[model samples]
Target chain A: MPNPRLFSLKSDSIPRATIQRLALYVQVLEDLQREGADVISSESLAKACDVNPSQIRKDLAYFGKFGVRGVGYYIQDLIASLKRCLGIDHTWKTVLVGVGNLGRALLNHKEFKLRGFEVIGAFDCDPFKIGEEVSGLEVMCTKRLMEKSHELGVEIGIITTPPERAQRAANHLVEAGIKGILNFAPARITVPEHVVLEYVDFFHHLYSVAFNITLSQQK
Target chain B: MPNPRLFSLKSDSIPRATIQRLALYVQVLEDLQREGADVISSESLAKACDVNPSQIRKDLAYFGKFGVRGVGYYIQDLIASLKRCLGIDHTWKTVLVGVGNLGRALLNHKEFKLRGFEVIGAFDCDPFKIGEEVSGLEVMCTKRLMEKSHELGVEIGIITTPPERAQRAANHLVEAGIKGILNFAPARITVPEHVVLEYVDFFHHLYSVAFNITLSQQK
Candidate 1:
């Protein structure tokens, strides 16, 4: 479910860029909260995050006017609002398939957990790891993936399998009732329209950096 | 050094998105060229990639009139221009830091080599992994990263280490004479003015899908 705070904010209008920035702003605020900085102003947040105060104001405007004209926004209120808007307020029970290196790394990673995506179960064909735990999360066999996820109410699936097996993994995720799939495999994948897919290519990233660096040098 | 072709193309004032898409079109065309397709047009190119033909023509306009307006875009000519624009005409030498699952998976990946990025070496701190070969590429100690990289004239560094070590890897890369960094580590990194840094965060992909799904639900 989407955050009501985000819905309440932009009953009028919101730019795509503004919506995307909410994720970044939430991240910065989360860092602040961890640092014990409870009370913050827009100017301060902007300075620390290398963003413009007005831009921050506009981004927050999407959800609603939580900011005071003079006193500034309450830290907890904005954090809670952003958290809801970004779908991090509650726990995100996700399923990860193709538990290879990238998949294992993601499962062991605390970043997603900190952001609210808890990968409750992982899938793999490798018998050696299928019954083991990687950083406290159990590795379930692909055979039991759909049932486990269905019982757990997982709507998001992280696909970290290899390029060759990515399509098969995606098909399984869709069949298992996952509506959102993060395909880290390099090869492009086709999922049903009901399923939203994003490709996170490990090697194409290197290609992009190489492309940009090469372009900038040419100039 | 950067390719002479990319230098000549971007100097003509192409929009960033167009330039990026142009590179992709060139890649697809290269495949078509290999299959002996000489007179391909923008419509076929867009169809192959699921983009719009008008957008393709508009993007190509920035790089001057390469389209015949009737016979379609010249495959050989357009490919040559795109290769130069993206700076992929020359092979790029790259290094990977952090031989963890993510790093080793990439090291074993043969696609990077096929895409024109040669993985000259890999660096990590694991005592057992050092002096070992993965996918035929030797894993070297992070301690010798700078020396070995300079010796090989490596131009790009991919940071796949955990977030805590990501900055350290970037620092080492910068000190080692690398010009660009592609970070798989989930954090922001600071580098000098000359260094071109790009982040390929899997979280961004997740959050992006999350937001889109949320918005569409609202609709």
Candidate 2:
């Protein structure tokens, strides 16, 4: 139940924690819908998502009212509103840089399409990769990244290049006017203030879990 | 500065967010040390890590005093303490399942070694991939996962299989006595409550940035 007032709130006013929680909610609601659950209470949804029930209510309140006091939330309606709120309702055209192993996995990853992200183009510096078709899209040379990205109206850039080349690839993507970037290169890359950059460091995730386990064993 | 009291605190008493921040601090401190910096203030560290200065001080206080009020924190001391706190001071033997493109990327990812994680073994069901040498280790059949993991004293299990096989791979890993798992299959797989599972979904990161950018544009 996203209300009009929630929709009108200033974007900057919303806490980043709330936005992150919304992402979790989107996944949880989608799963609930698939399971044929038409109505879900905040407590049930929180348990399914491994979050606190009160946290769910607080986050949803920021987005607008979505629950009827006693009956809980309508799963389908919540899914649609969360999608609209997260902007996944519209397909985002994304370009992948680097056709290396990680890049190939990304191209073959079907979940992206299911979540409204379409990898429309790919770029690489290797001559062997250029002109090769992967996931039905022909790989282009990095030289054409800026030009091709603009031509295809790509809004998001995914850099799977090596650490040494990540910064250059980021610069090219920024020049191409990408509004957001998901950089898989372990190296950090700088982007303009207007563009959002999120690094996907699989090692970070591994390290987090490993650290916890190590600490527990020490006890 | 990390205090002795912080070191004495039980793992459960420390917040997960604090641990995550410690990981980020490890990276930042390592980078600063390499650049030959001797001392860093909370304010400077916050700017570098994109975190609040007060938050940095609060997190560090949990571990113990490492910084001098006037001169800031000693760079080398901070690095060692963070690494010790994160359990990265000791290497963790890790085994990877699914030697596909993503798995290959993980094996070749040098950051793993730098961060104190050693991928001692790799597993895959594909006959073509099994026995192939990658990043100095030969790929083994998935059937050998449990036996080899036990023999090698592997502490972590990394799953990079397709969504359909992710759960089975996880079960195999759990059976092998892995204390932690980092799954890259883009599918949710359950593990025993004792085991920690972290999912690496590139779409989730992309969605996070996309949502923020969309919200900004709406304003």
Candidate 3:
């Protein structure tokens, strides 16, 4: 289920960059927590995340104060707050479409469960992959997506189909009432303005790093 | 070989955010190029990229002007400039570590080669996968990473290993003289100050979309 108060706050006030940074903070915080770090100073957090300490302080300030004056922020408390703020404190029922290599990797990825995005259904158009078990879920044909999504209350739709079929997968998800889509397909698929969509383009990261390395070498 | 002229022009003047947006612009431009569009206005590009039109103009301004007063940007001109600016015009010889699902998916991904990133070598610790061929490259044992990387002149190292082995892969790549790294492993591995590192955490995108969908629902 969607968080009731997720948008109750003024989105206009919170910059998109802040939201992105908040996600980064949560990742770094999660790593720290895994390393048995009980408390972390903003300086160390910033360093780990490769951002300025002041930026961390400012981002957290938007959500209210959580850091103690001298001891830094409690790891568990900060994680909890960030999770709640990012709307990941509760489990989100998700479905995965396209069970190709990338799709299977995502299905087998353990990190999603740790963050509460549980893939309850898997679908693909390939007849050979249909009925195959991947990471505990039996793969279903794409035709059943609309029917099964409604039955399972799938809230998040992940499209890992090839570019040719990505739009079809997206339409199926939208017709089934998925609230969010994380598209891994290279094709850009249109979604309703109300439905949240994020593209995980590996090339984007590749180009960014390529450009940064080029710039750094110039120095 | 690294682009020499990449930094002869000012580097400090450009914001990293602009570098990122440049990547986005390139992606959109490439798509348009495939569709056979020769020229595109900033407004249309912004709509496709989901960024403000003004933001697009500001980003392009960093790398010198390419837009005509009334005709918008020449698609071929923008693509060529972006490739040069992002250092993707020349092929980057890259090596991949790990032959797992994600590794396999990345190996099979054609977009990288299209963008001038060629996976010249593949490495994994698993004995069974070491001799296998994936996407025309032989998967070598991790022990051979240093030798193979040097032999192939690998400049970009892609670590798709599990979290536990990610750091080792990074070290191996660094020791082998890789200048940049694209890490798909969940673990955050550190490199020397000079080495460029970019983490492609799928969970980050998952969480971002989840939060966004929650916020959209609340509205």
TM values, all candidates: 0.85, 0.92, 0.96
Question: What's the TM-score of candidate 3 when only chain A is evaluated?
Answer: 0.93
- Docking outcome class, model 2: medium
Instruction: List model 1 lDDT by residue over B110-129, tens digit each.
Output: 67767778888889888998
**Per-prediction count of colliding residue pairs?**
6, 12, 0
* Number of the top-ranking candidate, with TM-score as the measure: 3
lDDT of 1 by residue, A1-219 (tens): 545334644454455456556777777777777788777888988876667998898777667677777777677788887777766677677888887777777777777777878788889877988878887877888878788878998878988887778888888888898878888776657888878777665444555676668766666
Candidates, ranked, DockQ: 3, 2, 1
Ranking by TM-score: 3, 2, 1
Query: How does model 1 score by TM-score?
Result: 0.85
List where candidate 1 sits over 4 angstroms from the true fold.
Answer: A1-20, A39-58, A66-74, A125-133, A141-143, A202-204, B9-44, B47-50, B74-80, B126-129
Candidate 3 chain A — worst ten consecutive residues by lDDT sum? A6-15
Worst 10 residues of 1 chain B by lDDT: B3-12
Query: What lDDT tens digits, residue by residue, belong to model 2 across residues B106-201?
Result: 888778888988899999999999889999999999889889988999989999898889999999999999899999886678899889887776
Between the candidate structures 2 and 3, which one is better when assessed by lDDT?
A: 3
Which is better, 1 or 3, measured by DockQ? 3
Task: Quote the RMSD, in angstroms, for model 1.
Answer: 3.4
